[model samples]
Target: MKNIFDKKITNEIIKRIDTLTPETQANWGKMSVSQMFAHCCVTYEMIYTEKHPKPNGFVKMMLKLFVKNKVVSESSYPKNGRTAPQFIISDEREFGTEKKRLVDYIIKTQELGEQYFDGKESHSFGKLSSTEWNNSFYKHLDHHLTQFGV
Candidate 1:
């Protein structure tokens, strides 16, 4: 997995995001460009904001047992795979706003650097290594960006 904390890789990802426009169409899947952008932002929001409610004890346990490995491992998500409920963006969103918010979150994550995430407790999973954190962030962004053919 590419390290999102690396300046060069972060810049490359941001450039890919810049390629997206309101009129961009998905290569597959149902999301419009704006909804896709908002969906992508949910990951960062889980880390940096309290916008989504945390899963309860049983749900958290299930996530760690059944979902953590696939999510944090250095593996690409299968196309059209299931997404968590918090990540489902059903309604239309402002393309420009969602795009800008995503870019800002990427910038914030990069600026914070890997040290900030080293051994950090994830919202769903327990403590994660920096490598796991990198994989989770980079892989998700890459998947969605590729979805839009950026």
Candidate 2:
């Protein structure tokens, strides 16, 4: 897995995102480019905003037990993998707005850098080491970017 905290890798990922446009079509999956961009934003939103509700104790336990490893691992996601409820963006979104928001979030994360995320408590998955944070962030973006063939 590429380290998102690396400046070069971050720029590469941003370049890939730049390749997407309002008319971009997924090679698979139902999300329009706008919806996909919004979906991707959910990850950053979990970190930088309080929009989503935190999981309760039992739900958090379940996520830690069954989902944390898959999310933070170095492995790539399987196609059509099950997403959490918060990550499902069913409505149409304004493509340019969502794209700009996603890019802004990426730039913000890069600016904050790894120190801000090292040993950070994730919204659902508890405290994550810096490597876990990097893997989770980079892999999801990479997967979705590849989904749109960007």
Candidate 3:
């Protein structure tokens, strides 16, 4: 997996993001480009903001057990995989707004870098090593960006 903390990789990712436009259509899946941007933002929001609720004990355990490895591993996600309820964006979104927000979030994460995330406690999955954090962050962005053919 590419390192999110690496400025070069992050810049490349941003370059891909810049290639998107309001009219960009997904090569696969159901999301519009703006919805995909918002969906990607959800991961960063879970990390940097308190807006989303943390899961309950049982839910957290389930996420940790069944979903953690898939999320944090350096593996590509299967196309059209199921997503968490919180990640669903059914309403319309402003393309410019979501695009800027996603870019800002990416820049913020890159500035914070890996050491800050090493052994950091995630909202649902407890503490993660830097590699796990990088895998989770980079893989998701890569998956969606590729999905949109960026």
lDDT, each prediction: 0.93, 0.92, 0.94
Judge candidate 2 at residue 13 and give its lDDT: 92
Candidate 2: how large is its RMSD? 0.8
Report the lDDT tens digits of candidate 3 across residue range 1-150.
788899999999999999998898898999999999999999999999998999999999999999999999987999999999999999989999999999999999999988999999998899999999999999999999999998
The ten-residue window of minimal lDDT in model 2 covers 105-114
**Worst 10 contiguous positions by lDDT, candidate 1:** 17-26
Clash pairs, candidate 3, are none
Residue 125 of model 2: what lDDT?
92
Candidate 1, residue 101: how far the Cα is off, in Å: 0.6
Residue ranges of candidate 2 with Cα displaced over 4 Å: none
The candidate maximizing lDDT is 3
lDDT tens string, model 2, 17-54?
88888888898899999999999999999988999999
User: Which pairs clash in the backbone of model 2?
Assistant: none
- Per-model tally of clashing residue pairs: 0, 0, 0
Candidate 1 vs. true structure, TM-score: 0.97
Residue 18 CA error for candidate 2 (Å)? 1.0
Which model is ahead, 1 or 3, in terms of lDDT?
A: 3
**Residue 57 in candidate 3, Cα distance off native in Å:** 1.1
